[model samples]
Target: AQTVTQSQPEMSVQEAETVTLSCTYDTSESDYYLFWYKQPPSRQMILVIRQEAYKQQNATENRFSVNFQKAAKSFSLKISDSQLGDAAMYFCAYRSAKTDKLIFGTGTRLQVFP
Candidate 1:
């Protein structure tokens, strides 16, 4: 079975600094996708960034980016110039190309301290 691990239960970042959330996964499949989803207090899970295993380039979206280390099976999310609005519970997720299901890691709560 595939599993995602988030060692940090909570993280804090200053309003304008960068913060990285670590995630590692155990998967034997060669074809899969990694994602970072943000669930704010509203409880809606929004996609932050996504990376396909076949691509060597890390995925990026505005202030959010992913450091994808395929060989080590590490997918970390880096948020730059953080804002209070970015404070949320971030979940690292994995989806096999063959299935629509998403296997999620225990979430890391991000606190944006002004």
Candidate 2:
């Protein structure tokens, strides 16, 4: 079984500021993919970044990055230089390589302040 948890229910960040959202997961399987997804008010699920369990390096995309700790089962997302457009519901996800099943967290609502 694979499960993802976003401990923070809501987060606020000022424009041009940086914010980190915490996430953790539990899985008995070894091969899997961890992901961060953002969904704005318009209702679109966008992939922020992804990290493979086997990869030692963390995943990064533009201002979005992840701190993936395999041993601790922690995968947190960091947003640098946040903008008003970045305000959205962020979800942490896990997908198994064998089952190809994707599981999502409850989500954290990010509020961008001026």
Model number with the top lDDT: 1
lDDT of each: 0.96, 0.96
Clashing pairs in 1: none
Residue 13 of model 1, lDDT score: 99
Model 1 agreement with the true structure over 4-104: per-residue lDDT tens digits: 99999999999999999999999899999999999999999999999999999999999999999999999999999999999999999999988757999
Clashes of 2: 0
Model 2 regions lying over 4 Å from their true place: none
Candidate 1 Cα misplacement greater than 4 A, ranges: none
Q: How accurate is candidate 2 locally (lDDT)?
A: 0.96
Model 2 worst lDDT run, 10 consecutive residues: 1-10
> What TM-score does candidate 1 reach?
0.98
List the candidates' TM-scores in order. Answer: 0.98, 0.98
Writing each residue's lDDT as its tens digit, candidate 2 over 51-98 gives 999999998999999999999999999999999999999999999999
**Please, what's the RMSD in Å of model 1?**
0.6
What residue pairs clash in candidate 2, if any at all?
Answer: none
TM-score between model 2 and native? 0.98
